[model samples]
Each structure stands twice: as C-alpha cells, then as structure tokens.
Target: MENKRKELLFSREDIQNRVKELGKQIAKDYEGKKILAVSLLKGSFIFAADLVREIDAPVRIEFMTTSSYGHGEETSGHVKVVHDLNMDLKDYDVLVIDDIADTGLTMEFVLEHLKAKNPASIKCCVLLDKPSRRKTELEADYVGFTIPDKFIVGYGLNYGDYYRNVPYVFAFVD
Candidate 1:
C-alpha cells in the first residue's frame, strides 16, 4: 500500500513542528491586535485548529468554503463560495489560512472577495506551497512547506476529498 502511494513528503511530526512554529510567529505578530483567523474550510480545517491553539492571544475564528475544483482535480480558475464568514470585518486583522497554495486561483478569489469587506488587514498562511504549479502571481505570507509539482494528499490535503485523514503527506501516483 505504501509503495502504491509513492513516498511520504511531509511526515505527521514534520507538520506538527511547523504548525507550532507558525503559531508562535502569528502570536508574536498579533500580540496586542485584534486578529480574526479566517480558515478556508474543508481542507484547512485541521491546520487552522492546531495553529490557533498555539497562539496565546485573544482571537476570533470564522470559516469560508471556496473551491475551484468543482468536480475535477484541476483548478477551474473560478472560485465559488459555498459558505461565508460570520464575522463582521469592520476593524480586524484577518489571517486567511489555507491548506495549500496550488494554482493560487482559489486564494486570489477569496482574497478579492474578503478585501471588498474592508478589513483592516489581510494576510495569507498556508501549510503547503507548490510553487511549480502556480499559474498566477501570489505568495503566501507564511508557509509550512514548499512542495514540488506533484499531487499531494494527506495531513488535510486531499484528492476528491479523500486522504485528508492521512497523518502524513504523500505523492499520489496513478
């Protein structure tokens, strides 16, 4: 079974250590500020939860579900919002958390939509960054790992909503 999955990219312990570091950085940066963590749902759920716990400041949480992979593995270059954030962004520093930044279309779409609400600030944090597959000019403010141009699954990353429960990251070979 392991052979069929190629090789482990990032192990479970690897992600945990990185997430802890990211949380510390975020906590220090927003020490005395009103931070709102807007986690991209379905994929970033686990990462966001773990990250927020490491922060030692008062912060609020909200979720936004957007997908450019409507029914396929490739990005459609168009994002659709399935769920919106519940918090009002009148005066808050918003940190958009995502599982991975692939083609960057979805993050770009979400960023634009969130910008319209007039938040005080908006920053991006991703668990994985696949620079090879990027089709747009976008960079994550914080990233846990920089992966190659392969379809990865595990540690909340998935294909068709599978392998998200896998404890480690692995390349999918078909």
Candidate 2:
C-alpha cells in the first residue's frame, strides 16, 4: 500500500471558520424558518455535524447515502441511494449538504426530486466545488472551496472508501 501523502488543503481551523461563516449566513437567511438539513451521508457527515451545531436556529437533520463511485476513484454517472431519509419534507426549507460537487449529476437529480415534493425551498451546500468537472449547470448556495480538477480525499472525502479519517485534504496520486 502506498503511504498516503499529507497535504493541507483545508486545515481544521479553516474548516471551523468556514463552517461558522456558513452557519452565520444560514442562520440569518433562515431565521425563524423551519430548516431541514439533508446531508448526503458517509461524506458530508462530519461537515453536517459541525455545521448544525453552529447554527442558532430551529433545524432538523437527516441523512441520505448515495453512491456513484463503486470501486473506482471517479464518478459513474449513476447514483444509488443506499439509505434514505425518514423525514417528511413538506413545508420546510431543505438544505442539501455534500462533501463535494463534482459532476453535479447526482446533486441535480436529488434537487429536482426534492423540489417536486413541494418543499418551501431547496438549496445545496457543498464543502468543495470542482467546477471544472461539472457536467450539469447547477450551483451550490454555500461552497467551502473551488478546488482544482484533481482527485482529493480527506476531511470526510474519500478514496476507495479510505483516507476520510484524515483531517486535511490530500491529492490522491493514482
């Protein structure tokens, strides 16, 4: 096994600060509104956990696990919801959180699906946005970073379902 390299894309402090900023913005935007934070699981877990604690509002949390990368390090354009949320998203402002936005195909599909449920509003928030790889014309309401088009893993992101325990982002050289 190749020893994973250490690269500091976003430090712990950096994540904390940005999440606080996002929380502040979210709090302000959805003050007194029923907010439903729908986190794309296994990846956005850490980010969603931290972000929700910072928000000073009445918010609900749910998780959905969708996978498009089966045994590879890239997307397959097919997202499967391994787990689904149990919340009834009727009149809430749904905020979809993910670790990164790559092809946007999955995000687009999820957003459209949720929108059809007659939610008051729906938005997306991603920890990283690799716009260079986007195949769909979707944007995140809150993005932590606009990274170069490279395979990265850490801070809840992963490679081969590994390296997500790393606290910082590192380029995975395949």
Predicted model with the maximum lDDT: 1
lDDT of each: 0.88, 0.86
Q: List the residue pairs that clash in candidate 2.
A: none
Residue lDDT tens for model 2, 64-134: 88888775878899887788766568889999999999999888988987787778899999999999999
- Minimum summed lDDT over a 10-residue window in model 2 is located at 1-10
Clashes found in each candidate (C-alpha, N, C closer than 3 A)? 0, 0
* Candidate 1 stretches greater than 4 Å from native: 1-3
TM accuracy, model 1: 0.94
**RMSD per model, one decimal:** 1.7, 1.5
Off by over 4 Å in 2: none
Candidate 2 lDDT? 0.86
